[model samples]
Target: MASWRISGSRALLTAGVALTAVFTATLPAQAAHAPGGVDDWGTVVDTKDCVQADAWLVRVKGLGKIIDTKLFQSHYPTTPQAPKQHAGGRELINLAPMGIGLGKVSALYSRAMGHAHPATTSGKGDVPARGEVYADAGGAAVDIGLPYIQNPAGGTQLSPFGVHVEGITVSAYSQPGKPVAFTGGAARGYISVAGTRIIDIPPIWAVNLGVRIPEDYTQAPLALATTNEQVTTDVKGNPTKGPNGAYKYDPKATSGYVNGIHASVLGTDVADVTVVHAAVLRDPKITDKFAVAPRAASDRAGVPARPLSKSCAPFAPPRTAAAGMKDTSSCW
Candidate 1:
């Protein structure tokens, strides 16, 4: 329903010329994967019943007009940067990570209804507010600091077979009122019984034991309260009131540091787990337009959409690696 096309012959010509310039400027790497040598999985498993939740806070400040003006003139000489500096201009002030877990029901809704449901439910239908906020604030603070640099060390993991580990790990500097995007790797482990049925069902039967190593990230928002003494000065500038007021600040907002831990269970075929379809729940009144699509159990039969990789050679360890010794290792 939505298109990303820019119109007009002039605009098209300009875009085509710019694209050609960019492609010609850069050389393609030899590796089949991206620069980091990580394979990308295009799709996730259809585990229709799971829950996930997270919370974060960030702080961002503008670098003042001088920086803004320079950035504006350099990037968009024809138009004001404030209105059209669409890409690459921002700073991350403070980014602290905390933890937020979605309830079991909520996870189930997401798995069944797809990301769009929870995306809309969370009041972020398409545009990720967290990332956009940083982009905007960081763009404004370019003069004070360098443009926001994506943590190359953090990002999604794409497996060889098109199994995409969305938001595996990410890093963000702290800023006020800005939220960092959550990207962490996830995995599920299970044991299956070898047996054959007389009829249509396959010979192999799979049973989900649980998530072997749960998804984890240390980048959620944490709230902290501190007291600062504000001495009211008389005309002579003498100290006035004692430090008594407590100011509440999300640590992630100021530090741009986040540490989070996440866990969840895959659904069992025999268990008949009850789940809320986010799309349906978000718009229950729309009879003509079904928000949530029904997901039959068969959709998850056989091998999971995202089978674990045989090796973890391509991926770097999680961002919060300690002593270079991780308990478990797998791409997805």
Candidate 2:
């Protein structure tokens, strides 16, 4: 099971924003697209002849500005088999007193772990590029020290001595000419104080972020997902209008991502952390040039693809109960 364990030395890092504990798990050999036996840990991966996953420890910011530098980071392209990744360090200076770091620990520690993978299975008679693609990251974790702390109001908060975040995952799956499906969450983890468990953190799904809604339908803290059906926009961030009085949408584009933790103190944002993140895009103009059947029929018919689901898969951690993790059974 995924439990937050406080130890002598642990570290946390991230791409941007707040700082918080995160957890990670090893990647399994079988792809997430496989029917079963796929361990969900960090964010899964996706593809468009190109896909990538990233994991990192701490990144500190204050007053909307970056203070600490980006720490150990792991980035890699998608592959046939899932790959495990880990990164961490010790003796880091927590500049919280100076209004830049997450906590006031003199010797802050950090670490991150996760798995990422992208697998594609093609169908015969590839006229219009018929195939299924799956990308996911699982078993993510990150930790940091908070021996002593002061809130934004200048009071001793008696913060935890250590913090550990675990069980973060994200994934995306799709077929040619179909809308991309995204699924992931933070599950089965907690924070600690003085080497003892304190509170249980609830699972968070990317869909609830509300960053992109009624437009993209799903949102994660630092993630983005999209498809060709998205509306085209002008440079001013306004939707473009076509000659037929209808909104113009880009004929090609797609993406996916996973959720991580963002740590804050007394209402002030400190750091942005992610156990794993994956992204994928598709361009129909380029992809359809070699299609066995012309894609114009669907375009002429104006047949929009199926609507995306409001929920996603948990991509559960290693050996942990997947009881709460939801799956898009309709897609399967």
lDDT of 2 at 218: 56
What TM-score does model 1 achieve against the real structure?
0.15
**lDDT value for candidate 1?**
0.15
Give the per-residue lDDT of model 2 (tens digit) for 117-176: 121112211111123333333334444434234445643343443344454444444335
Q: Give model 1 RMSD, 1 decimal.
A: 26.2
**Candidate 1 per-residue C-alpha lDDT over 1-332 given as tens digits, one digit per residue, 9 for 90 to 100:** 11112121111000000000000111112212212332111011122111111111111112111110111110100112112111121222231112111010000001111111111112222211111111111111110111122224543111110011111111121111222221111131111111111111111211110112111225331111110001111111111223573322221221111111111112221111100000001111121122113322331122111113311101222111112221121112
- Each model's number of backbone clashes? 52, 43
Provide TM-scores for the models.
Answer: 0.15, 0.37
Residue 73 C-alpha lDDT in model 2: 26
Give me the runs in candidate 2 sitting further than 4 Å from their true place: 1-135, 145-163, 173-175, 191-199, 203-206, 209-253, 263-270, 288-332
lDDT to native, each model: 0.15, 0.31
Write down the worst ten-residue block by lDDT for model 1.
12-21
